[model samples]
Target: MFAGAAPLAAQFPSDSSEPLAHARELLRETPLVDGHNDLPWRVRELAAGDFDSLDIAVHQDSLHTDIPRLREGLVGAQFFVSYVPADLIGNGAARFALMQMDLIRRMVERYPETFVFVTTADGIESAHEAGKIAALTGLEGGHAIEGSLDVLRTFYDLGARYMTLTHWASHAWADAATDEPRHNGLSPFGELVVREMNRLGMLVDLSHVSDSTMMDAMRISEAPVIYSHSSARALDNHPRNVPDPILRRLSENDGIVMVNYSPTFISQEVRDWAVTRDSLVDSLRQAFTIVDVTAPDSMVVDTAGLRQAVAGWTETNPAPRAHLEQVADHIDHLAQVAGIDHVGFGSDYDGIDAIPQGLEDVSTFPAIVAELLRRGYSDEDVRKLLGQNFLRVLRGAEAVAERLQQEMDPIVATIPP
Candidate 1:
């Protein structure tokens, strides 16, 4: 249906690698839906939310994503993230989330020829058939709701298909993977949030939550949950990655864990190197404190000196580079533990600073497809990884929502002050 668009098979020349040519052919037939991307946040940070300032229609050297690269990647659909900082919990977080959501909407409006705003599994397919990319939105933190089910409902109405329960810090009702456990898991209100999300056909994303929180949400959610952007913890031991136990439970819960491409999450060596570097930087900061600290307990360090010290240390001890093979290893591990139907991709592109070697930008997705093919993955299995798995989960949530809406009322419970 794409007039003047090159035929799928003709996109690759005869000189292209056999696996790469095959990978591109497979992607054209199947919608390669990425679970998470932070282009909206990148635009907010770099362009002050002005699409004109950083036009994505052409190549953008400064960012990992743009329309040209996404087309090169053959990405059929993408979940544009409306990520609010964890610190915004009580201080107008809901408003900030609204602004981010509005930015996504504006993006669709501005690039109507290239993007089709989609909220359902079928919508993605429709967009793909029309040779346009489907643009969907996902909230990156539960803190964006500010502990209110009403706000959660409003976000779903605004087209948020999923929400990570927490970011780097634990909030009022949920524990974060990177923070001290306050709620242990989901608090009473957090459980209610999951239930309400199920009823609304919105996905319960467990990417940044603690293990306890993952277990709690998995046990409570009627709809299948998703790790919008995470890797396998069994491989790297990063708190941000999913453990084998959770991966095992995915089949029973009928959930999917979209493997992440972040270097720290994919490679154990890289993660360890980061930890040591951070410790060294912290020690260096202790010796060069700022003269005027505004907060009594805060120790502000001279950033210039810290940067120089870290640069020197990095020069001496270069960090290990994670590669495409390591990413495939994570995907292979997830499929081994969680089953093939539950494995998918959520590259965390534009959200992370460091990326795996070959998977440097959005255009590199075909390289992953080629890697998996070389590893003996059947085209059918690779198709599932590309987008079928996520489509199944999306439809599953929609089915559950249809059933729940007929039986239950909207949750109005609020967290007690």
Candidate 2:
């Protein structure tokens, strides 16, 4: 599957065409390294694992990402998320995770010319040199490992470089950002998981874990930790956003905080609206008997029926829109607090229901670059925010793994109920 030789954005004109041109020029030198994108899960939902149905080599309006859009965005590397819903943690979660991983591998296999499978920073640069997007795997949710160190190691073997310690729900061993604390941070097993991840050179992601968990991991992890997709909680006050205290710790730990683009995380006004909107949706779901909207099973969510049921509610209670500037504000705040070296982009594209106005799809990354440039961010600082920061974190993790293997034996600690 050969893609067009010309970049997609080359043909289109943006409002800030001058800055957009500058952004394109910068990307030519330093391509954007996105921390997370959920196109794999979207494919699972839309095509039921059938690549032929939603071939990314061609354009797909239903998705926020595609091969063409990625090229347009000048994405040097992407960590495609192999996400499993938290509800499935106990019931064959590990099996589902394998399936997700297989989908990502198949994606790379199917489009070799456009994407190159990569696990290391060097691999990313090599792929970029070949004019191909470096495809990396990131497992979202620790439940994917199902409480076994062997499973965690197996995922790393399968090309997953990072795993979010928890998702929306708390794991048996770890606490989640949104869920009530069960372990008061991380249980002994959770700490072991972090240590083992350190040993294996897998980046321990703190995106969905609780604040206490973030502190605990920072205190324990020999290697740097990453908030794969989070914003500044000081700005938005969401549980999913990182607090200032954690941002300060990231500088000492040598970690990076990839700011999330979710409207809920970016704007407090949007978050308030979302809360009301979600409450209304929940009420409608109960009234109309729709179960598991986010479930892997396509049959679990009656998409059309739910839409019709909630049509009036949606019309009356519209979702507030966030702007690209808000997204940059998050990056700015995170940089001011965490240092520019610790800030990067993680759009969470295809995973979130809506995006900010100027950043509607993958092709709009240049707009963000333009925004940062307008804010007096130097070309060098912008480059670090775009990709260099993440690359540094990746290299740091690899180095820690090498040193840990030399010094400490493999930890085999267990959780106690």
lDDT of each: 0.92, 0.88
State the lDDT of candidate 1 residue by residue for 1-417, as single tens digits: 112123333543434588798899999999999999999999999999999999999999889999989999999999999999988878888999999999999999999998999999999999999999999999999999988898899999999999999999999999999999998899999999999999999999999999999999999999999999999998899999999988999999899999899999999999999999999988999887876567767667788988998999999999999999999999989998899999999999999999889998999999999877766677778889999999999999999999999999999988732
Pairs of colliding residues, candidate 2 = none
Runs with alpha carbons beyond 4 Å of true place in candidate 1: 1-16, 293-300
TM-score against truth, every candidate: 0.94, 0.90
Q: Whole-model lDDT for model 1 versus the true structure? A: 0.92
> RMSDs, each prediction?
5.1, 6.8
Best by TM-score: 1
lDDT string for model 2 (1-417, tens) is 012213333433344467678888989888689999999999999999889999998889999999999999899999998898999878888888999999999999999999999999899889888899999998999988888888888999999999999999997998998999999999988989999999989999999999999999999998888988999999898999999988988899999999899999999999998788778777766566544667745435465777786787778778789999999889888888889889999999999998899999999998899877666677788889889999999999999999988988876654321
Point out the worst 10-residue segment of candidate 1 by lDDT: 1-10
